[model samples]
Target: MNPIATKYIKLNTAIPGPRAQELLTRKEASVPRGPFTTAPTFVVKADGALLTDIDGNTFIDFAGAIGTMNAGHCPPQVVEALKQQVDQYIHTCFHVMMYEPYVQLAEKLNEITPGNHAKKTFFLNSGAEAVENAIKIARKYTGRKAVISFERGYHGRTLLAMSLTSKIKPYKYQFGPFAPEVYKMSYPYYYRTPEGMGPEQMDEYILQRFQDFFLGDVAPDDVAAVILEPVQGEGGFVVPSKRFVQGVKQICEQHGILLIADEVQTGFGRTGKMFAMEHFDVVPDLVVMSKSIAAGLPISAVTGRAEIMDSPNPGEIGGTYGGSPLGCVAALEVIKMMEEQNLPARGQQIGERTMQAFARFQHRFPQVGDIRGLGAMCALEIVKDKESKEPDKELTAQIVHACNRRGLVILSAGLYSNVIRILAPLVITDEQLEEGLAVLEGVLEELCL
Candidate 1:
């Protein structure tokens, strides 16, 4: 068995070791190739910021199940809550039976999510569902048809959500005849800002294009909502300035278009703040949330202004498992954990440290083209060269694969798939975080140097 010297990551064998290989064979037969997996090995256990494969290899989990474990895997309180909840009941179907946890979680989200305005929240099964429902509510409230989403923004995989998403390959390619009336707009990618334009100028240009779009493409009055990620997720963790975000909000207000904050990956303390929207000081009419909401539970929420949220008739929204009791209970505990432990501040610390390392990487490795993040949601944009600034998709994949093989779980993002993203758990110890970063650094040194 091959092993690496490390504190938390214990590489007992090659990534897909004997045991994992057997399971992989089975998985290949049973599971479709459509659903992608970052790590080749199957995880037997996970906790805090670490995961153990079936082969007994332990890995520091930087991916955090694609930002679904900000509170960390099997957080004690959340696990305990789920256990107690299971002991009481598992699925009563909130649609059929009224449950307190559902109402309790909704109340908690409304209170914690940005904006002091009277807000209401409803639960859903996934981020895509939340996006779909949020759009429905926006359209119902405004009686408008068209909706606008930004370039490189990722909403979800469902029809409407996929239509709203910007990425083409893997997500939208061959999945067409996408949802109609959904439009795309340019979101500022400052790193790749046009040849001569400055960041603020770029922002103004994109904002102005909205007016041009209204005249050339669709009327602003017909737009029900303009959805955006406060910090783009699959779009490479790209963060827009407060001016850019507020500009979008101003336009929405001017045209009577609802602003929907798709915080699926940026919410739940992942972005340092409780929600990324707080960074921009823009309160959205509708907020789409999932991922870290329930500490890995398959639960999502649409929290927004009470008036906008209540636009749909009573039975117009909701599903069989929309607000499962276990999800509600786990979410309640997750929020309590975030609050009592001050995870958002911890997330900020993670981002600071991560960006610091990334900055050093930029100086040391020419391929480390750009580094940007908000809170713990950090990323390194890989490029062929600093001058060319051409995306190095191959190198990014190699870095990710090398890191995973060496016992650090990581992920890739961006339209070009050249952004190495870090979504480490906030509860990770400094030593663990350092060790994980060290693994990544080592991979960069090996691959880029």
Candidate 2:
């Protein structure tokens, strides 16, 4: 193999070297195939934007644990907080004994989440749980059973979340008897807007369809909430126009249906804002947060208007591990770190740099069909050809694998799985970011050109 000359990446052996191969063998034998993993090796250590594998190979991490590490891997403040909290006490079971950190974090969320309205916040264990609870609260408050989600949107994997999610192959295939009263609506995909429709026209068209939908399908009065991802994470990083988002909010307002923003993957400075909803100048009645909220901690939260959140009385919601002390402490430190370090502004810089590179790639490669993003949350759609715009799923997979082999960990997104997405940690330095991008550009040149 050609010698690698770099500062961050150190590939002393081929991927899955002896030690990793041994682990991989054991993993295949012991673990189920259902849980998918992008890289085929086990990590020994991770910091900032780099990961070291068990086999002594180091790589630049561009996936950021699927957007869970916006504060970077094991951020010093979060790690230190976790260390201190672990020694003090672990789980007091927020329900049984309660903890100060839980309430503190909730207050912080309520203060920071969009709007000046009086709001309340509660914690959960995962993004899916937050979504489920948000829907539950909306239903209870509105006395409605129907919920509306958009096409190509992804919520999570649990029963109700899976039912609302748009993907089928890995997430929902054969997961029968999905939750009842969940409806799907059309979200604008500007790139794929039908033949002659402009983005504005498409936005209006989709918004108008809601009227017909209320008439033909579930009535607006029966809808409890309309859940949206300001920038669709798993749906190929598709971003909606301000008009579309506001239009949806307006419709929800007219029908007295609550609007829920699912910020699972887009929260915590991923999209140049603390929450993606801020980009549209729309304030959702309810918000679901997780992923980067606690820098990989298994904690999620639902923050909403006070009256709506109070709909679920005592003993109606919450779980044993929700808002564990460790998660709360770590999240507190994460929020402080984000504010002190100004990561949201950093996210904007990353987005600018990445989009510039993507623009260059589009000019050079015929397979580059479209480049789109909202902030640091960016993606490049791979296609058979620019004109046809047929999703090149196979090529997309090949590009991801090639970049991985070259020691740049990346990921693919989109309903068709034909888009390369960048979720690199906000803490990544300019040199590290450029090197990782170089690796990706090289792979694209080799595979797509």
Candidate 3:
């Protein structure tokens, strides 16, 4: 570990740490109304994979800012680059005037993404913007009006993003009149087994369902794109089988429809691979990436075959804050950090460690139900009955709260909210991870045993 990351704080009381509680009070008075906070602690500062609360208690970071900061908190190279770029310039709309960092980062993304074919990239300020722009590009390129997305997949919070996203209770309950021409498909989640369906049954049911839609409801040629996450994120850290992913690719190819891989959460070394799609041989025509790309500096992009990307007319895709100098500089440094640390390989190693740690829990706790994941990204779906595999949402939430009290912050997902998703920073110390997992086991014991 670097000198900048060796510092650790001591915990003395219930989290909010007194000072954080005061800040939380001030936040209720001044902060925006929409942002919902999960924890009682208010951070004073963060370094490496640890966050210091207002009272100076340190907590191991597991959320990674919802899949950002994969390079870990305030990575030295990225922070230094941000500092240096601040002295130059902040924003100059790329459409009005080009900048070196933007062009350079785009080049890096194009070259690094899975493809040797000619490709181009467009920068955006957020993941939602990138998804929205991808729709524009796909529509322009294919001259089609319909798009298909998977169930339980999370795109973003924008109006159109809501339509593309499939979760109803939380993401889409009252947000009506979302963008039109968006269709939904079932994501391949093997844990719950969908209607008590087996793997082979699930595969056939999903395929036949899509075929029915294509033949009965909509014409395949009218479909512009089918957007999917290589590995589902917020919906659950569901890792689709190689057969399922390849089957989807085949369907898209048969209809001449474009395939869009939403790697916003899975990209930038979240999975063992740089992009989650690398686990399989399937190559998508377009790849949407964000979150950790810039190591938390708010940069996102859509990259793929140049010919399709070029279909958009001038002024079709550009943002004032898109690909800011600081963001691009941060991204370049993030890439350098990944190379220097071999983070992708490290991600694979972390996955192995997670498996080892989780296996012990599986043996002791029958309610573990299922343990599934890849690289540094993984999740365990809890159950009411191990044999029945019924979603135990209440149990999962209890486990999360217990873990929080133990100083391990974890996030939950899945269609029924019974899954515990773990997305730790790829650079977290092995000792921290082991300690966090041990706390997590204790939380499970309290909830299940």
Candidate 4:
């Protein structure tokens, strides 16, 4: 008997078709508008890189739940592990009664994350929680009050993370009285750099600005950590040069300030490397991970040097449901799958292919102002024209909606909301990837050309 070939995607109805429309009505009434969604319809089932709506409209998912499903949805081994965990126990909670899976996952993270130093890890419930706790650990470890995060870098939605985040309208707008002592630093944006300034020059300029910032904004001794996303995610897949990242690390080292790599969106093989820091050959003092950590389970972790992580007292840095048994088991399984399949290499391959496709699109359309990425995490900056490079936020929305209606699920990012980002599962098949890109290309042709 021959195995069935994967069809990948099938759209029998309009995106909201009738069933999704009904659910959308209920969602509007029951759910607040605070939580934003890229896809217009709610999904009933997801597998690998495909999401099936209640209306039977199947979409090739390019968003990957905002970079959470690198191992793809409902991976059989992970699912089995989760089931076994359920049968044995579910919610013991790390604080109340410690579990083996929690410790095991911590050990795995310590071993695999980019570092040779002795490391320790603790779990949390979400990426934001991971960021929040990482800051707490850094502050306690350094005995300082100020934390610096880059402009256009996104941490999370919690008060401290929100305060650290760069975007304003949605993530921060009107939400003042924010966490204090958080300073915004200049991050190099090479594409938007002053004409004639090369990448190296831009990096140098930003490093110099960092020095000036320390002199003007806060004392270096008073700073706890410098947090950054290796490749800015919500800031639109902005890939900083390796020199710049290392420079920041150097500054932190010189000042005795911890460098926190916010790997929440870039860790666990979304990037070509297990952690984006690996690409730069710089090991961060502290690493915040979540998103793809547990195959979409609501679990996150802060992994760092043992000494720094130990700074927080036992009772000082944990929550009731911090490391649920399910999350731990799922994370362990996810890690195993990532290693067994070498998903990072797969992500690298995907990135190359997607970038090639994006390059073609850029050549065909003047509105494609920029095509940038670090790995499989790729994005396109939409513009009103080639020369002006004015962000086309409205056109970006049109492309996103059109793609969704045509059986593709994509997302918009960046402070301007004019960038289209691709976070397709690393496990996505070549055919599926080509098909999804084709859909996007068709949408671009219709709208831009």
Candidate 5:
């Protein structure tokens, strides 16, 4: 039998204990295998940073729904707002009849997101939809068809977004032909830089390639935009230097191309800032946001310069369920909660504590190859050895599964699938944070040592 009592974790049975096993059987019978799951069991309830499974086992949530719960699960304010909205109305599509909440959210986003310049905001239902629309607006405004995205940056699974994405296997394999005129560029990976290349040199090298790329591959004037994830999320929590980000912005400016910051995974205090682009002091012409925008509600937004956003005619860009009433109300409440609670500052504190723990793990384990992140969006890359630095994809998978079995919910990512990333909620208590990290450390000792 598994342990019955712990401070936060309570395991009354084995991981997929009886109840969860029954659900898993039913799930396998009905659901396709295409959608992957990190944790094996099914949840009965979830709160701030913990999840209680159907089998009565409780686990610390380090994944935070892939960085979607920055304000935490079921935040009271957001929930209350949602309930109030449901009582009033659920869906009165913005296209058919406009609502107060939709306009209110737009005002809040325009004021808080990175710039003081005149901006306009519009809503969609998912990150991919926002990216797709951002591209449409950019192309319509600039009259150019080419788009560039960084290597290992993930936008979403939609055709155009997927074509812009760099991962080839599970995300794009055999699902072609891909959209045309999408290009890939190098993003600075300091830890994995070629032997003897200093960090500054690596940044300069990649920036220089942009010039060469324009000359040899596509003319800059023909490019609509360059979309980037301020800090690469699905490509592992790879954080680029401020210099690198600003350099990319400068190139976009010189070339008359729009800069699109895909903040789907890094926005709403996931990275110790309201928006990750603020960290680099680069104001993107177009910003794509989702994930934590409404505390896991299926809503996305594209905020851009007024002139650029205005290029699209009224009927050309909206969907039937574009901005649901519930989503807008929840998002407005979420933004209010974030400001009142100062969640971004709290995220920075969590990040510092986690990074310190990772540093200690590196001292004790040879397999802990590299640790990198921005704010609370932290990740550790696992390798075969420090010297060789060969990605240990198998070991990474084992560690992740083992952690899950032991009442800690963690996930792995990276181009090589060898990175263990933590996306715990910004509202997670210090005690919950420490307990989760302790479980991770214990697993590392058992697996790596």
Candidate 6:
């Protein structure tokens, strides 16, 4: 039996209860307030699929640290492994003094990261670092200056990552002089298409938008790579169709541009497939990965064909705390847990159930303009007008707040901030999922009314 499931959260009162507020107050005094949160509430302890705040109020956790805990919080096996590693040692810098766990993780990633060819992995501290290294590798390997990322594709927050990321409000608002030469392209988001086109035609139009806005202007060969998210997380769970991915891959291949799948958010079995790229059958030259790779530790990786990953010379990429033995051990255990739990297949099942519930929601709520997903990663992009597909940002916020009030943690995303991204831990129980979904239904009914 699966051992990573949550027991239950006893809801004594509203979320962020009281003790959470105390911690929040403490945090405000101790830490900078900028990177804090737009989302309300605070957490104290999380185990499996449930979170108990400091005030003793328990809430069902659906955010799952932005989909970083695929195996659930403090899974016994992973926790045990971490404890054992803490006893042995913590940090020795994997690059300075080699560790078996790091090597073991690399070996596992090389074998599992969506390709049969000879592959390699470079570990880092976060998704941004992984993405930065990927861009560096692509540029070095191809000897090019320009990179092509998609609209609404979020890479990370570093200068280069922000440059690669497309949203501007807060992520790139004041951060200027972003790494120059990085360009944006069109991704296949079916909901917000320019009116009067079928799905296929819209996809082609976006493809043309790429070649026209990019290749028509800049020399394709000069572009080093095109980074993408298979099922965009923060940009709304926009699952680009198989054909759309194939079309983009063809364009990149034709232009001698390497495809960089930024599976940082969608990889590590969040999608039904191990890697989201597997759904499209397109093998990227470089795949940037992170998030749940180490269960919850701050570790990420860029895994790809040997040639590209090998382009960086010694001392070209690494960090002081990147891929510590603890993180590496956590990653190894995560992979083992996923395989044992058959998380990829389980993701499909969860997606099916979640989608069915969303279908019922759509039937009842006119605001639910679109419901899309790949696996446990699913979402509903609220719209003011069904035909116009205008973003109902206000309504989306209300829905989110309502969900939080009801003791179910939910998250919001999208370019216009109108999409609710549902990224629960894979270990959440059917009972807990149903409870959360019911709360979601109440929120939808309450807000959409």
Count of residue pairs whose backbone atoms collide, per candidate: 0, 0, 0, 0, 0, 0
Residues 254-318 of candidate 1 have per-residue lDDT tens digits of 98999999999999899889999999999999899999999998999999999998899989999
Off by over 4 Å in 5: 1-5
List the global CA lDDT of all models: 0.93, 0.94, 0.85, 0.91, 0.92, 0.84
On residues 100-218, what C-alpha lDDT tens digit does candidate 6 reach at each position? 98888888999998779999887899999999989999999999989988889999999999998989986889889899988888887777666787789988888778767664667
* Count of clashes in candidate 1: 0
Instruction: Tell me the tens digit of each residue's lDDT in model 2 across 1-449.
Output: 33346799998888868899999899999999998989888999999999999988999999999999999998988998999999999998988998899999999999999999999999999999999999999999999999999999999999999999998978999987999999999999999999999999999999999999999999888999999999999999999999999999999999999999999999999999989999999999999999999989999999999999999989999999999999999899989988999999899999999999999999998999999997799999999998878999999999999888889999999999999999999999999998888888888888876
Q: Taking the tens digit of each residue's C-alpha lDDT, what string does model 3 give over 191-289?
A: 667666788788778887888898887899999999999999988788888888889999999999999999999998888989999898899999999
Model 5 lDDT per residue over 1-449, tens place? 22323599888898889988899999999999999999999998999898999989999999999989998999988889888888888897888788998899999899999889999999999999999999999999999999999999999999999999999988999999999999999999988999989889999999999999999999999999999999999898899999999999999999899999999999999888889999999999999999999988889999999999999887889788877888888899889889999999999999999999999998999999999888899999999999999999999999999889989999999999999999999989999999888888888888888
For candidate 2, what is the lDDT?
0.94
Pull out the clashing pairs in model 3: none
Identify the candidate with maximal lDDT: 2
- Model 4, 1-449: lDDT tens per residue? 12223366677877778887888899999999988887888888889998988887788999899899999989999999988888998887677778899899999999999889999999899999999999999999989999999899999888999999999978889888899999998888877988899989999998998779978889999999999999999998899998999999999999999999999999998889899999999999999999899998889999999999999886999998888899989999999988999999999999999999999999999999999998899999999997988999999999999888888899999989999999999999999999899889988988998
Worst 10 residues of 1 by lDDT: 1-10
- CA error at residue 322 for candidate 5, angstroms: 1.3
Kindly report which residue stretches of model 4 are placed more than 4 angstroms away from their true locations once superposed. Answer: 1-7
TM-score of each: 0.99, 0.99, 0.95, 0.98, 0.98, 0.95
Candidate 6 worst ten-residue window by lDDT: 1-10
TM-score of 2: 0.99
Error of 6 at 235 (Å): 1.0
Q: How close to the true structure is residue 286 of candidate 6, measured as C-alpha lDDT?
A: 88
